[model samples]
Target: MTDNLNEFNKGELIIENKRDKRLDNALLTTYEGDTLLSCVYIEHNSLPELSIDDVDTTTTFFGKQVPFPLMINAMTGGTEQGVEINEALYNISKELGIPMEVGAQDVLMEDMDTAELFLGEIVEEVNRPTVLLSNLHANSSVADIKVAMDTINADGIALHLNPGQEIFTKDGISNFVGRYESIEKAAKEYGDKLIVKEVGFGMSEEVIKKLVDVGVKNIDVSGSGGTNFVEIENLRNFDYDFSELYEWGVPTAKSIINARNISKDITIIASGGIKTSLDIARALILGADMVGISGEVLKYLIHGGYDYAKDYLQELMYKTKIVMLLLGCKNIEQLKKTPYKLTGKLKEII
Candidate 1:
């Protein structure tokens, strides 16, 4: 046990290798299936008297006024490269007043010293009230969850449920028997501060109900149509194939509606394959209080560096406001009340 811990701390070789490979694949890989954003289109208001100048993009999330209802969801953490990515994203978050969740804390849980050398230093350097969230796996204990949150001084903690990813991974843990029990314990202990979310597979009404039953108040419906973990895992291992499950999971738009139908009050965060302003607007109309983005930002940051990524996000914010103006909705609240129609495959799914 001591030797294993020492090896992890020595160079974080395992996580570093995984992180590098995932980053490379994320750049080249294209996910299968629809995000359902294309299936639903927001109604254009011809008589919209609202001007772009009058549109307000600010919305309250995590009990604070965020410039927009967007969050940079968990991406990478726990290695040298992970630290660099976290630092860049953190600077962007600070500049944009956007919320971000640091990548998974598996390494931190395995070796505190490794995390101190990788994620902890960056967290300490960038520590501030920027709506930072700590990320943990679903099977993590409440104690592990607490340590992750405290490490980053997280405003909240996002426990990602990636059963599909785990099931498909070559040597990943497949035992999710007590995941709900873990979530329930965390929710009871932290209440609204606990965000129970899926990795890329959308949450169904049943999943939402179970989470709400466990006292969870925030849910990120990170649906398919983005970075397909099944695909990623497949890329990781060529000896086995899982292509048959490429299009698995619910679409983002439908998942948001499903979550809304289950509970009117749960703070729904729409994510997965969210790239354009139309996607964000459609998500808001479908009952998403917030939208989480990961792949798009990572792509931008990787290809174009920090400035390019920042500019891309700024453009998204602009497009979202333009969408609000076009919809004749001056604010996010009004946008939610705006009417929209589902078409094609999305309507069929509904």
Candidate 2:
């Protein structure tokens, strides 16, 4: 078993190597250029005409008043390079008054030294009333969840589900049998704090119902049609097994619509392929309480540096204001009630 584990770790290292090599290429190709999907489309004759400053963007999340309803989604934070990325993200998040989520803490769960080096230090450097979120894989034990939360003093624990990524990953764990039960157990044990998040693949209406039944309060609709984790994993492994599944899950816009229709009580975070402020507005109109950004920001930060990423975020903010003004909405809540037509693939899904 030890030998098997060692081989698996080595394979993972190789996959990581390939991923890092293609990182710049992917970012440059997708974001710096424009082949990426925005996942938002304005209906014919539906554009609103208004001044940008007249648009209000403030919204409340987790009882905290955030200036914008945007969050930097969990991306990385176990390796040395992850530490630097987290620090840069922290500074930008603090300045922007947006929440930030760190990558999964599986490494920290195993080693106290690694926890202190990677997770603990990142949280400390971000020193602010910022919404600091910690992450755990769905199969994480209750004890592991507690350790992850305690290690980072997380404002909320994000339980990430990524079975598709696992299947494509060369050295991945595929024991997703009792994830619902495990999440339920964690929520029951730590009901006041934990937030469940889907990674890349969106949650079904059935799964959403089950989670709500299990007492989970917050959900990130990390839907499909954005950052294709299956594609990413397949590229890393040189495999085509799950390539079809790359377009398998629901879109972020559709997920938010389904989730809102089912339960308006839980906080809904719309993510997946969200890249611009127009995407943010479309999500809000569809009932997203907050929008989580990852791939787009990662692209900028990794290639162009922190200043470039900050400017990108500022551009998104500017776009969001324009969206609000056009919709004749003042704040995020008004944006939610703003009338608009959902067409294209979004109409088909929702």
Candidate 3:
């Protein structure tokens, strides 16, 4: 049996077949339904003990101090334009003092020389770092995972589970066998550096417990209601319609609560349909160690380029500080302890 040149890599294949279509589809689908962020009503403090100037909105990732807990989540990569996108993202991540998880790096498995193609030369050539993170599929081998991480000297690596998105993709894989074992192996090898993540399909407490049981300490519960990948893939496939499943997966707010209840130790990144500073505040209140934003940042990047995206993020972070002040929470720790109630759909879920 000979290897098919055209069918070599799923990451490459997804890029080649779709090119900027994925980016375009993502931008188009940035529109989201109720993320249940509305269900989170952070109690206001009539008497905030500390002044706005004294609020400490600081956190850490990769052992480096960040101004806030916001993170730049995975977007697109593994193409020429992807290289440019990554560079811009690097700039923004550096300016904002936050961590960024790059898009899929499975393409580098077949061609390691093209590391610059997937992660950008900026990452390869930089002296000062931005707490960069590499990403790969869940079932990747330890060898493959190492190459992806070592390619750009990533501080951490995110192993993403996107079975819901895959089922909708025309050329996506169906065999998820050994996924748990593969994750366990990566965790054993990488330990605290390995972050198990979901795409837009969200995560359940059961799923998070499985990861926690495997010794995984970082989890990005990229819940539903952002960049509907099912709709994106189904739109690409003229052969069939998966519209009915477009709304699948847990809401972002509830997923945060789920992870918070499961364990106090694991780092939970609340993402999916995160559109505002209040959303960021609500996530922290519900137990997310940090907040992640992808589509909204991508929208800002596409609409106005790097500078616009940077300004948007800076403002978002500033507003998150303001939210902290309003809640009478001087720091991220206080914000987490701030009382809030879950109502509506999210109330029923938890």
Residues 1-350, candidate 3: write the lDDT tens digits.
Answer: 11221132222432455566777677556345667988987777888988889999888876778888989999878876676677777767887778898999988887876688765556555455558889999999889988888887888899999888887788888877889999999999999899999988788889999999999999999998777898888778888878777789888887887788889999999999998999998888888988899988877776666667888999998998888988888889888888888888888877
Q: Which structure among the candidates has the greatest lDDT?
A: 1
**Model 1, runs deviating above 4 Å:** 1-19, 116-120, 125-129
User: lDDT score of model 1?
Assistant: 0.82
lDDT for each residue of candidate 1 in 1-350, tens digit (9 for 90 to 100): 11222332343343445556766566666666679888777678888897788898888888777899998989877766666667677778878999988888878877886665334355565446568888888878889988888887788999999998888888877788998988899998988888988888998898999899889999999999898888888888777889889999988888998899989998999999899998898898989999999989987776666777888898999988988888899888999998878899889978
- TM-score for each model: 0.92, 0.85, 0.92
RMSD of each: 5.5, 6.9, 6.3
Runs of candidate 2 exceeding 4 Å displacement: 1-54, 117-122, 125-127, 239-241
RMSD of 1: 5.5
Evaluated at residue 343, the lDDT of candidate 3 is 84
Q: Each candidate's lDDT (Cα)? A: 0.82, 0.73, 0.82
Going through the candidates in the order shown, the clash numbers are 0, 0, 0
Error of 2 at 166 (Å): 0.5
